[model samples]
Target: MKIIVLTSWLILSVSIAFSNAYMPLKDTELESIASQFPPLEYLNPLDDGGLLQPFLIVRIPGTENSTKVQNHVNDFFIKQISQGQNSSSSEIPMWKVTHDSFQDSTPIGDNITFTNICVSRDPELAINEGDKARTRKRLTLAAHYDSKLYPEGFIGAIDSAVPCAILMYVAKVIDKALTRKQAFLNENGVGNENNQLGLQILFLDGEEAFHEWTSTDSIYGARHLAARMENEDIENVDGLIGSGLSSIDTFVLLDLLGAANPRIPSYFSETHDLYNSMRSIQKRGRNIKGLFQHKRRESNFFSSPSVSENVHFLGGTLGDDHTPFWQRGVPVLHLIPNKFPPQWHHLTDDVDHLDLRTVHDWAIIIAAFTAEYLELTNFILDQ
Candidate 1:
């Protein structure tokens, strides 16, 4: 009897330990709080029903501005793709764009330029909202915006465009919900409110630098952005560093997210932080009596590479845009689907081949994580 009792106690202790290691999703009550976006159902052949439309640009000037830029970039893609446009490419290009504004002398000096490129709904959404004014924690969502260079008739849909759209949608949902939550609290005479977090959506250029994957071919923009963010010391605000505990907060990179019944790889230790954040959102959604709740299972759908944890490219590696950020030690949660999508790099990656449900789920997960992180940090909520 004593042995059985001790064994039961040990099991209970183990369960609790594991539970403490991670947060749980809310009470299985995910409700839809988003507006019915028409683009979600669009099917025009002109631009793959709008998937090829380019939209959004987010700048993380310093660590303080990272999160907002990340979220903004995330939301921008979500809205663009949800409204019917096929996501063409999702990359955060960090480059130097220099133009000589003269006819006499060579352009003054070479300027390092970082322009995020992703096909979107329209240019209007790309515009930056006026400065929020406070020192903020920053995070980046990097993806390529250009579709594969398949035959001219091919849409190259799965190559990357779909993932970009999903990121944009998630950002919008989180931002919109926060805005509404504050309003609701105000309406109910609640005394206090939290500030909003920022997210930058970096749509990269030259990801498929060459036709195939070579050391020098892919990750053109990512390399530039990573170098710049690490090398530059633009601000004097000491408070911003403290916001992230004097470390880079997070850089969630999205890739092959449009495949049907996708499976995310449980490949990195850093991903647990992100998973915990998502669970927090699920909980908050339930606690606040909101629409968001247990819509996803937190466990990763796939396993990490069998060969080497440090080596990103291995026997069964799926090389997407997550490499550069990981190289910089910025904790990247790369969201790649089960396997490379079949329509990838092909002409058939059109509206018909895409899966709307997968896109929707992908957007939700991103939103959940953002909301949870903002809440847990108490940075946005401390307002």
Candidate 2:
């Protein structure tokens, strides 16, 4: 009799504890997430010089009618963020150097036929700034913008297109916050002393592939960049954090976020701090809404508590863009949406598969972290 009573009481306690811990996302929050990426007045149909025109179907968010509007906006941001290709920049060196063009170098001694090869500079130049109290503390949000190699049908919207767009929102917000914080500090007489904290919004160029997946095929761009940063001469770099919205920081890549709210695997337990950060942001978003009840609220998709203890093994192939950084001892937090999008790797992966609320929620989380890392508070008060 006593055993039976104890068991019942134990079950009741467990149930009550779980009930108190769980919190469902509300409608207002969803609306807030949708608003993060406002719809575009116009969209192109191809990825051109920084302007992306998504496939009409891929642009729509959700599998239902209710999310159409938000999906359109999300699609716009994703499309627009891929405006620039691998262009030459002094800030970040492009290692491609051609000694003799195909027209210049050549077929040995016989005819002197020109030959060209893409050569990478001996991974120098970009180095990590020594770990500083403020500098060593960084949260890097990385995403690859390139689509996978498939027929015209594959736009890779779910694979990584959405993640890239979301990263940009984070980049912009953090950039703004950091700049403001810097200004604040200066105005208030504080200088670079506390200006070391930073957030690197890394938009990798090639995460997809041309041929087989090898060190040279996928993640070439990010790998090359990270290698350079590890060169020991770089300055002002610290810790690293990678983020995606589809899945929590379990490092599980999101292949299909455009589907309905899919089930996320039990992967968050593998990466504790990152999981904590995700939950923290979700909590913050909820708290903000609760506090400003009369005002507006924001939607956050990553609000649930993760209960899995699954530790994801680094799948041999550095699946996404974050793989390279993770390889170099940099901590990575990958955020892939649940399940594979129906249009994944197809022309169908166009705008229709996008969700504005998803993008918006992602943007909020990114913004929060960027603000935290960059420590932009100095700008406000100093300025």
List model 1 lDDT by residue over 93-176, tens digit each.
111112111111112222322244432211111112332232233445666654433355544455566666665555444443
lDDT of 2 by residue, 328-357 (tens): 444444455434545656676666666544
Error of 2 at 151 (Å): 1.8
- Per-candidate TM equals 0.57, 0.54
Question: Where does candidate 1 have its weakest 10-residue lDDT segment?
Answer: 11-20
**Which residue ranges in model 2 land beyond 4 Å of their true spot?**
1-138, 191-194, 212-215, 235-271, 287-300, 303-306, 309-318, 377-383
Candidate 2 has a TM-score of 0.54
Error of 2 at 63 (Å): 32
All candidates' lDDT scores? Answer: 0.42, 0.38
TM-score of 1: 0.57
Error of 2 at 298 (Å): 15
